[model samples]
Target: MSVSLVLTVMREAVIRILVVSGPIVIVAMVVGLVISIFQATTQIQEQTLSFVPKLVAIFVTLILAGNFMITTLKEFTEYIFRLISGM
Candidate 1:
């Protein structure tokens, strides 16, 4: 493949990764920030307190977005394969 084609594929792969991961990362960040605020206010610095909620929130996000993420990945994979075949 040409350098331009390789770069295009890489760029598309990166964009797809960002699209797939953005929601879960954003939700976890927000949940973690809120939990930090609550911990600061209430002074309940339990270790599991931080871990559990973020984990649960991420899991929930994955559950809710799972189909969308899968569909996106499938499309990306198909596009990549087609690009390869075309080359």
Candidate 2:
């Protein structure tokens, strides 16, 4: 593939990854931030308090968004395969 074509594919791949991951990451971040605030207020420094909620939030986010993520990745894979076949 030419340089521009390669770059385009790489760019699309990166964007797809970010789009797929963004929701879970955001959920984790929000949960972490809320836990941090709670810790600050209550002085409850239990490690699992922070870890468990964030984990659960991320899991729930994945459960909710899993189909969208899979569809996005499938589309990107198909696009790449088409590009390869065209070459």
Candidate 3:
């Protein structure tokens, strides 16, 4: 591929990755922040306090958004296959 085409593919791949990951990341951040605040207020300081909630939130996010994520990745894969076929 030409430099411009390669760059375009890279950019698209990054954007797609971010799009797929954004919800889980945001959920994890929000859960972590809330857990931190709770710890600050209550002084729990338990190591698992933040980890468990964030993990659960991320899992739930993935479950809720799995279809969208899969569809997006499928589209990207199809685009890549098309590019390969053209090449």
- The number of clashing residue pairs in each candidate reads 0, 0, 0
Q: Which tens-of-lDDT digit does each residue in 1-87 have in candidate 1?
A: 789988988998999999999999999999999999999999999999999999999999999999999999999999988887886
* Model 1 alpha-carbon miss at residue 67, Å: 0.8
Residue 17 C-alpha lDDT in model 1: 95
- Residue-level error in angstroms, candidate 3, position 45: 0.6
lDDT per residue, candidate 2, 1-87, as tens digits? 699998998999889989998999889889999999999999999999999999889888988999999999999999988988998
Q: Which ten residues in a row have the lowest lDDT in candidate 2?
A: 54-63
Task: Give a tens-digit lDDT track for model 3, residues 1-87.
Answer: 899999999999999999999998889889999999999999998999999888888888988999999999999999999999999
Q: Between the candidate structures 1 and 2, which one is better when assessed by TM-score?
A: 2
lDDT for residue 68 in candidate 3, whole number 0-100: 100
Each candidate structure's TM-score, on Cα atoms with residue i matched to residue i, is 0.94, 0.98, 0.96
Model 2 clash pairs? Answer: none
> What root-mean-square deviation over C-alphas does model 1 reach?
0.9
TM-score of 1: 0.94
Candidate 2 runs further than 4 Å off:
none
| 1: Cα error in model 3, Å | 2.0
